[model samples]
Target: MPGSFHGRLFPQNTIHLVHSSYSLHWLSQVPKGLVAESDLPLNKGNIYIAKTSPPSVHEAYLTQFQKDFTNFLSMRSQEIVDCGSLVLTFICKNDEEDGCDFWELLGITMNDMVIEGLIAEDKLAKFNLPLYAPSIKEIKQIIGKGGSFKLLHLETFKLKRDSNMAEKEEATLFDEKSRAAYIAGNMRAVQEPILVEHFGEEIMDELFERYGKKAIEYMKNYGKGIINNVVISLSKTN
Candidate 1:
């Protein structure tokens, strides 16, 4: 059946365990202040938080994540039986400003299109990704405040460029263009739906084309970008 995780979807005290993977990073919706009705968008020219994003932009994203994640824990606590547990794995950041290069690269690619008249500058200015990679400290604070689950384990890991590539793909990954294409393809898979919704399907191929080239340049200059993730085990409190 169709339901939203923002509310109770299961019978109380029925679920014994919950396993969520690679999903909590996404907010229920885009942060509010970024899409104000009358003023310019706060996070202009960047899809996600970037080095250039103002302090308010960063604060807005953080607030939304906090609210969404708190609701998530509250709903799960109701569904899970006493003494049951939950395991969660999702993207995270080491620091507030870290681990945004991939999105920044995509943002720059879109900006390039704007410069060339392929996309409207206002369109680029109004778009923002509804994703946040919270720090472990932030995660701990929220769970602690809720007083519903006891944190059992929490750890972070960096996703290396070659971590899960197949042998054949690994061999090809050594080539700059091939490696860029590989990463861009993966990014497109996750982001294309929202992108198409915002920018239309006509620009999808060209968007990724520019994105791949930007990735290649990043590889040559700064090496592969780091993708940080966190896994936590929590037990329901009595």
Candidate 2:
């Protein structure tokens, strides 16, 4: 389940439709050549490419995303039937923001915890979240590179942080705690093992606890920053 699509072969020409939701933005691994051997830390005091990150850092991440996504599309094209459709709903990076801005703010909190002597600066440097949110144009290029899947439909949707926990009875009222819990749970499912692997078991509870609180504050202030997501439907053509 963890291997690259190129490495893990699927049954060729068996599948009809594929639906990938809230996945595929994650790279298979950390980008190589993050920093030169001679120079100091390229992304010092930060866990990811921030709004202030240098152009080289952004280039490194985009390059890696292109490679991994190309292979993913190529493999899927071989597995699906002719004219089979694939619907992918993934976070997009646009004029708005990545769906994972919570992660970005969390990283900043981690830096503050380091300043407070709660965590080691080196640990922060070693930990980089392997995530990428591609734009529609970038996705098109990836699919084009495979030369198998034809784009059928593409649409953009927004997810407001406050809207994640709306009640069925009343759309205006928000369940803040439930919203926080849901976001925290999803993040824990994806990131707990990684955090534990790097920072040990002790940091898990406190880290995500802070993350949940940060999520609340983030929504309160920035109002989800109008997170952008793209739903792309592609068809395999013979």
Query: What are the TM-scores, per candidate, against the unseen true structure?
Result: 0.92, 0.87
Query: Whole-model lDDT for model 2 versus the true structure?
Result: 0.76
- What digit string (tens of lDDT, one per residue) describes model 2 on residues 1-238? 4655434456889889888887788888877766768755677666677876677777878888998888778788888899998898878786554444766777877887888888888788767777777777888888887788888899998876445455356644545666667667767888787777788888777777777777877877765645688999999989
Q: What is the C-alpha lDDT of each candidate?
A: 0.86, 0.76
The weakest ten consecutive residues by lDDT in model 1 span 161-170
> What does candidate 2 score on TM?
0.87
Q: How many backbone clashes does candidate 1 have?
A: 0
For model 1, how does the per-residue alpha-carbon lDDT over 171-203 read when each residue is reduced to its tens digit? Answer: 853676666677778889999999989889998
- Top candidate when judged by lDDT against the true structure: 1
Candidate 1 Cα outliers beyond 4 Å, as residue runs: 35-38, 95-100, 166-174
Q: After superposition, how far is residue 41 of candidate 1 from its true place, in Å?
A: 1.4
